[model samples]
Target: MGTFVNNAWYVAAWGNEVRRELLPRTLLGQQILLYRKENGEAVALVDRCPHKLAPLSLGELKGDSVQCGYHGLTFDCSGTCIRVPGQRNIPTEAQVRAFPVMEKYNAIWVWMGDPEQADTTAIIDVPHYGDPGWGLVDGQYLHFKSNYLNITDNLVDPAHTSYVHKNTIGNAAGEEVGVKVEQSDSHVLAYRWINDAPQVPLVERMGKLAGNVDRWQYYYLHLPSISYVDFGCIPVGTEPTEANKDRGFRSFSFNFLTPETESTTHYFWLHLRNYHPDDPQASDDVARLMNQTFEEDATLLEFIQREQERTGVREYARIAIDNAPLRIRRQIERLQSKEQSAEAAAMDCEAETAIR
Candidate 1:
């Protein structure tokens, strides 16, 4: 498994999931306690209590403070130990670590790295989120029994859709289409246009086109496992411009991937569409079809994960379609190295301070 970039903001749960009740979750192999204050502010903390390492989620919510059932080690939202049962003097070190958290775009995001460096601005921006004349289906979630990197690979590889998801969103028409890859500082995009072809099952059902159409599949993978798929179909021989694509039946599907463990992932997604902006039936169709499509990916990636773990190999060979996946892997390695070097330097600095 690749090293997780800890300094980034990861979605802990949907905004609705974190309420007045304490919710327990695991992110990047760490147990976390999430909840909302009485005033509606979201909060995150290490689940383990400092005294006995018991999970704080098992405790009761005393207003904004969590009172551990193990020993009544009550902690406030900032993870400061505010009260210790049967003791007038509270230990200075008796507190759980608080995680920086924020609620944005209908999700609660938590920072897993140094709290001093947490920045809410680092979170990605969702386009057309609240724009007029758009339909939104938000707060969707799924669980994947595979490494996150594997999902990242699948997200950028459109070739798999023809074989793995032929029934839902794929068709044999795109089997021969060539995919072009582009990379930037923070994202990798693998895109292609299947020109002058019959609409896939999804489009045929929703689009109701009269003749053959030109469709575009743009798979964008933002660094550290976020996916944005821009899918649409325009008229045959239509100018393939941004405005034209939007003019056609177009939708933006965003997938947020947060690692739950080395072999598990938390998948949060939202769908936005320009067509049928106010139709409840269209929202239902989008939800069902998208869920089915992602389930197909989840099933396949789980098998891939098992095989890879059994063989101790991530891949046996590389092919033409692996261009985007390979670039992401290299970029992850660079981040991993940079993090390790920073950690080592911090440790050395601590040692020097101790010597002084």
Candidate 2:
């Protein structure tokens, strides 16, 4: 299982999680220490100290620098060794790697690859995040015992909802409706409208509709691994347009998947809803119900992950519904291949320049 795409922005933590105290986290299989400076700027460094390879997370924060607990080796936020207590001169090789980080949309994102290529503008936009007409439930987290690709596959597959989420977001009405797939250079969209269907339980409670409605599920998987469900229902036979969706009950469920290792992921999520924008109770209900819904997914995916490992088989068969998931997989492989090729070309260029 591929751990991650290095040259992408991955959510390192919620903005509030990083403070003056050291926060240890793993992303794309790299041990990282995250903390905020006095001015509230976030910093990320290779968690291991160059001296004795001790985890710098085990050390204490001193202003904007981290003092290694083992030998009092202090390093600044730039990962440069600043002070060696016993020796007046610091070793040139005593510095650790520092990752590029940016705080935006209430989350801290880190780039673990070539720091020079870190682009803050590449971060995906969250729609209506701070709008006055929307209610938000952010800072939710879940741990998954499955490869991120598995979670991505599940996100793009709407057919499983019929059986897997019967108690929460699922119903038997749209089980046979085939999902339509579309793709762009940076994302894939799998969507279908379930027309004239009874509103699901949660929607029934929250929506103003009193009968069957034309509901839409637009499952979007952004490049690498961010997934969000644009879901809601309008009055039966209403045109399933963006304006209608906004007029009716609508919510954007955002899931930010960050790989902690080959077989595990950090699931950070939030929900935005147009209904009950002023009701705190509604927000609480949405959080509880959504958390339960995701936990259901987490449990099943863990079982699938374990079985895949046990049998050494990723898939036994592919059905018609696998189109969207397969498209995403191909996209990811292409990205990885392209990144690898770029790195190879850069290495060759460096070698030739050295010979000169």
Candidate 3:
């Protein structure tokens, strides 16, 4: 019945953010200590030491293990207590919880659920990530005061772009354009197209379209918290095909949302653009404009969050655009249900085995 789902992978930090030193962070409301071993392999552990409940991050890293500053209890990367400093025999309880972590797409993902279920294949694919034709803007981060679910709501609803992101990625031209929704077991998509219109500010700057053009916005939310926006503008009547869209100005914007707490989220974003793939300046511009756009959402969402809390109402009105967001919330609840059922079954099985 909790809003947080621990059975999924969440971005703990960017790959570069983790070093050999102890870095303490909270993910899914759990205190976690992150670091790299001597071989540069990433490790994530419960930040608390079992002995005195001291934060291991306050301690020092000794070669490949963490030495508890309070009592000198040392834990290896597997969260197994290997040294007791004064005692020769280590008790079975002298251990911590080590989360399963995987490094991919320039980010570190931590799984906070059953370790046996932490399959790396569930990680979503970022197409055209390393392709020579796509410019890369990665290792970007932002902090949001609103809940992760609120951010996911904003991501699925593109109707707000007209007003919220008018200065960056949205415009008045698409205000009347209706959006379409399509969903699957793994994702929810909300998108629309603006035909034969002037390019928005982002397009005019990075796209260099001399005249009216047709543009498309395809926003995809891959459960539980990956937001991918495939947006681009092409010459009016440019066929709207995949290859032709590639020929024009297209960009893949990805937002990886990790819940720092129930009300705060860590936003890690990366961008791949088809234009000027080799230009450093292009990458910088993309980062600036994208950050500006998301900041607009962040500020607005915080206000919305405050209002929802104050009034004890998250929704005052609902319309057609609510379809995608509604679907996402339902799917999340289903996942939570499945997790509860699985845990209950496991407990029953253990009880039966003990009785036998």
Candidate 4:
């Protein structure tokens, strides 16, 4: 919530974004260079060259290594200096810091903390990814001029949809629906069901619903910043069970929030829907609609962030709808606290060992 939880894995770029060419990006306040090696493996390193602090992004890519544009110093994918033109001895500190990165679910994830603790298994799963019956819309990106926490708050709170996304995914019928909240060690879920109601605009256009339907919105914030909504609709009077819900029109919409700075965020999103799996037209329509909806949020959030900065106040009041947002804030604080405690303990151990 405060800047970022660096110990966690964050989406650095989409799989297609990183290539043999050098690409520069800022994540968690650190400038990083991302590229793909000859074998198609993604690599991330500190953008600065150790020799003169020149940005590695300004350099040329040689094979899998980056050559500084000014000088002839070269660094490999591991951030080790493998070549130093006109030099016989390479300085021990001539290397840059390399980050742990991997490609999964069509996204490239990077670890910005202690490299030893970068466990790839900790990445959140996209269940419907690569499944036969799901239509996938991925490689979408947006830049939000707001803190990642602010975006997270909006994501887990469903009440704003009725107002913020009226033209796209929201309507007045869901204005008063009550939300149920639940939390586990790693995630918080806030969900609500709107029964005997007309489908929202997008759903109405996409699905063949009759008169009224039982629609659900499950906003799940998976630790730190990843969010996905389990949203769908079923005909009215149908049993509200998992199997029936899956059989109905359903979608898994994901948002991977990566903090670029305290005041800005990188939003990477993808959507998977059960219906229209093979309809290219439907996929294009979904992309257009979802992009419009998110842009609506981005515009509002930028203004909200500017005002918050002016007043130095995040909020003036809290309501029942804040249950999920509040829970996520507390969870994030706990994670930060735990990380700090672990770091301090490790420092103490190192100090004690050095003294002995």
> Tens-digit lDDT track for model 1 on 1-356?
35698877888999989989989999999999999899999999999899999999999999999999899999999999999989899999897889999889999999988788898888888888999988999989999999999999999998888898887778898999889999997899999989888777777777646678998899999888889999889999999899888888888999999999999999999999988889999889989989999999999899999999999999999999999999998988877787788899999999999999
Answer with 1 or 2, whichever has the higher lDDT.
Answer: 2
For 1-356, candidate 3 gives per-residue lDDT tens digits of 55777788888999999999999998888899999998889999999999889999999999999999998999999999999987799999999999999999989999988899999999889989898888999999999998899999999988888888887778899999999999999899999999998888888887557798998999999988999999998999889899999999899999999988888899999999998899998889889999999998999989988998899898989999899999999999988888899999999999999999
| Two-way lDDT contest, 1 vs 3, winner | 3
- Report the C-alpha lDDT of model 2 over 132-204, residue by residue, as the tens digit: 9999999999999999999999999888888887777778898989999999989999988888988887887
Instruction: Please provide, for model 4 over 1-356, each residue's C-alpha lDDT reduced to its tens digit, 9 standing for 90 to 100.
Output: 36578789999999989989999999999999999999999999999999889999999999999999989899998989999999788999999999999789899999998899999999988977999989999999999999999999999888898999988778899998988999999999999999898888888888656678999999999989999999989999999999998788899999999999999999999999988899999999999999999999999999999999999999999999999999998998998998889999999999999999
How does each model score on lDDT?
0.90, 0.91, 0.92, 0.92
Candidate 1 regions exceeding 4 Å error are none
Candidate 2 matches the true fold with a TM-score of: 0.98
lDDT of 3 at 16: 95
Instruction: Write down the lDDT that model 3 would get.
Output: 0.92
| Count of clashes, each model | 0, 0, 0, 0
| lDDT (Cα, 0-100) at 119 in candidate 2 | 89
Q: Residue 122 lDDT in model 2?
A: 93
The positional error of residue 220 in candidate 4, measured at the CA in angstroms, is: 0.3
lDDT at residue 103 of model 1 (Cα atoms): 87
Estimate candidate 1's alpha-carbon lDDT, on a 0 to 1 scale. 0.90
Against the true structure, what is each candidate's TM-score?
Answer: 0.98, 0.98, 0.98, 0.97
